[model samples]
Target: MEHAAPQAWLLLALWLWPLLLMALAMRTQWRWLPALGALPALVSAALLPVGTQLSLPWLLLGTELELDSIGRVFVLFSALLWLIAGIFVATLMYREPIGSPSGSNHFAQRRFNALFLLAMSGQFWALVGVDLVSFYVGFAIMGLAAYGLILAYGDPAARRAGRLYLALTVAGEVALFAGLVSLAAHSGTLTPDPSLLAAAGGPSLALILLGLGVKAAIVPLHLWLPVTYTAAPIPATAVLSSAMIKVAVLGWLRWLPLGAVTWPHWALALSIIGLLSAFYALLIGLIQRDPKAVLAYSSISKMGFLLLLTGLMLGQPDLLGAGITAMLFYATHHALTKAGLFLGLGLYEQNTHQRRTQQLLLAGLIFLALALAAAPLTSGAAAKYLSKPLLQAAPWHWLSPLLWLMTLTTILLMARFLWLLRFPASKAGWEGTAAHPTESSAHFELNLLAPFLAWGLLLALIAALPWLFAPASFWPTNSANLLLALALCALVLILSKRGRNPLATLIGRIAPGDILGPLERSAQRLRTQAGRFQPGQRSTRSTESTRSTDPTSASETALELKLRGWPVAGALWLGLGMLLLLLLLAGAR
Candidate 1:
């Protein structure tokens, strides 16, 4: 029997190897090597048994790495997704024509590969590390490295998206850093376990939620996801949607006192926010013309379910086991299926010339879509059944109908995605080269099969798991639910064909990243309005008129003047502090 001591290095390799590959890529010209970088992690995840631990006292204030149950599942799916996405990246680099034969595109490809490996390294460590500092280090690295991937295309939109993503990521990082410091300080330990944080409630928890919530793509904080993922390279988007997003969910699972503490206010608030985000993404997705944008919105919608489950766990701590299991299973299902769908889009772009190939691609699309919708026999179905008990419980019972409604919307959005897939390549922003007559169909088939097999294998695993280990009742055999979902899917497809999708048209008016546009416009208008008021000109205004001409403008100018001065702003802050002091004193009485 292999002892735990011998396997200590495996945990380190799982994360460090990618960084090694990243460094090698920076120094070498070989483009294909980085694609194989994830193999070590994948192999380790497959062979390593649970309960493996490695303690490093030399690391920052003593860090530990372990493969617990959650970490194992996370490593399995994350390594698998990264491995496949790496292959897809290699394929794109090799086959796709990029900006003439000049080596400039190759240089960009090299940069992309390095960044990809760095991001993968961060994601792996974030899940595997047990310590707070280790997790935060990994999370921050992943967040920063992904920005390069977002701007890989170097387009105007990609630049804009990269800036937006970076801004939110930085804000989240600040919150997360502060939260971790608070968590450590309050708990009186640098190496804090999540269970210990149960007593360290308040701003520590709130700051952590705000930080991770941004990465989780929770409502309002989620505007960066659809924009960034949609603009990133296809392979980058694949791992991003399938793997990187899970980091946030895992962070919540690892850092928060989910079942350990009762937080009714935050729990209810999170559940409500989750529900709104789900429907919000679905509605926005219906109108999007870009297939990638639709997938991004769909990802945000799926994330809402995870958030809801997390909230439920907070309320019903006794159900933590079930909730976490459901989340793991759901994450696994989404990672594979979503990655497959992205590659499916890439496959179609590459093989659009052949009629037979197009049909086969559509079949694959339907398979992935149905699985995502939680149709019978799919992994999503298993996940849904596992989570059903939680959703059906007390206060959450009110959300049950909404859950089904969300499913209906999911089916509709998937249908919309499939419908939009039929559009011309240019409309979808596909950059595939036309298939040469000499290019064999087998070549395209191989590329397409890479992601499909990954997706299909995951479905098979989930389906067999329920039958092999779970009790008969645990199977997703709710025939009525499946039937209802299928009927809704069919109804959506039918309505879509006759140009009678009135709801889609009406909801479609709201663009992808719905609130961002208005927010941006409002900010710009504020800036423009601010420019109209000269700083010293306020004195001139007072000299010119004895009577206030425009109360609104005068009030705005005065507010700006107060904000510009340190003394006035300090006095304002002092007055607010006194007010808060009085309120706290009164409350204490």
Candidate 2:
């Protein structure tokens, strides 16, 4: 009982500490607030034992928080990434002048810190929460907070990205809510277990997948990812890619009956979709000119790989334990390596004029990229090694070859990302500038050293991941594949250098959100054509005047115009509404 009390407090502190720090940051606007906020989560993840549960009967229809094996790994990596990002945030706060006590800069700094910490708290909450309501609450908070981060700059591009992100986030939340309701009603419980999940209906499963898929950046639902990554601040982008997106995978692991049932049809369908997403994202990623956009697509591809593993597990229940471990390890490796790259890129841009620092940053980026590519002796290699058994055990004979292809594609994408980093697009605002002129040398050095130390620690973790996790050899057994990928990348580089560079022509051809750009344009054209058929200004004003007397009519008119402004949004809302209605009806029946 004594042990239980401590464990419960630790679990609560893991999330509450960040919230408390967020409140303090809003008042103090302290530069160190972000980093300090992450400390409790880090400590809790490290100190807490597995299976530690904290139940709150009075909280959100009786919620429970537990540190299971999956949650332990997730919390550890997430806290590490958040902590490192917090360090980078501290440096950013230091560089930018906060101005006077009541200045706009001060307010902006406090707002950013508060949102960052809130997101951190929400992430921890979602990760540790065992019940439906707690998970949903945390997920929604994190998603909404991230929208604010995306719009921090409030530029046209940032606003546009924020709009898209919010729309998708809301859609995902609605789907998730409906799915959870169905699951709870069907199972007659809020907390899920193997037996309950196994009996979950097909509609609930599909809805859950649909909801989580948006966050997971699953193919068609992935349009927001690249745009948001490009528009958001670097630190924000780092956490979004590394930690936020992985929440969906955790949701899948929790909600789906991976080890309990063998649904071969769902398994095969998901596997095919995963394979397609991997290759499709790789193709789009290669053509991207922006480094962040490339990284975003890289995330999509990695998610696809995880989805493939998930599908395999669904078909073969026996692979569950090994599969989950492999997935968790891969997720950790990718999170650390990707976050390091983003942070390193931010550092690279900030120290552009410093020749020595630039060189060092470039070297670190290359190392991180190599690790992401699963090069020998790196974390990626180790993760791939761990997954080998699952792949070998799969009934499908063609899965292994496709996985090899995906790995090769990943190497190429990383190479492209590195190449893109050489020519970062210039931007206005704090992102492009450095320290204030009046700042002391000591402060500047400290700011610079903090980010480097955080990045270096992350790199060290990536390097040691293999030794820490992988059994047997740290070297990838499939060293030949790595060599082949390297050779291919080299050959392409040589050919491009020798020729007129066909790859250059492909750059920027497809925008960050591949289909979205065209879809918006098409919608604009359609709106223009439709406007011509509408009543003249004078007639429209007369009609509006007639309707203005009725409050409900005036509100409906405004709603109609707003919906008309966003053509795609109308369609999405209509479809979602119908789906929700059907789900409600089904439940009632």
Q: Count backbone overlaps in model 2.
A: 0
- Candidate 1, residues 246-363, lDDT tens digits: the string is 9888888888888888788878988888888889888788767677888999999999989888888888888888889889888888888888888777766777666676767787
Model 2: runs farther than 4 Å from truth? 1-3, 97-104, 423-444, 537-589
Q: Highest lDDT, which number? A: 2
Across 281-353, the per-residue lDDT of candidate 2 in tens digits comes to: 9999988778888898999999998998899889889889999999999899988888998899898877756
Q: In model 1, what is the error at residue 492, expressed in angstroms? A: 5.8
Per-residue lDDT value at 251 in model 1: 81
Screening candidate 2 with a backbone cut-off below 3 angstroms (N, C-alpha, C), the clashing residue pairs are none
| Residue 530, model 1, lDDT | 79
Model 1 misses residue 588 by how many Å? 39
Q: Per-residue lDDT for 14 in model 1?
A: 86
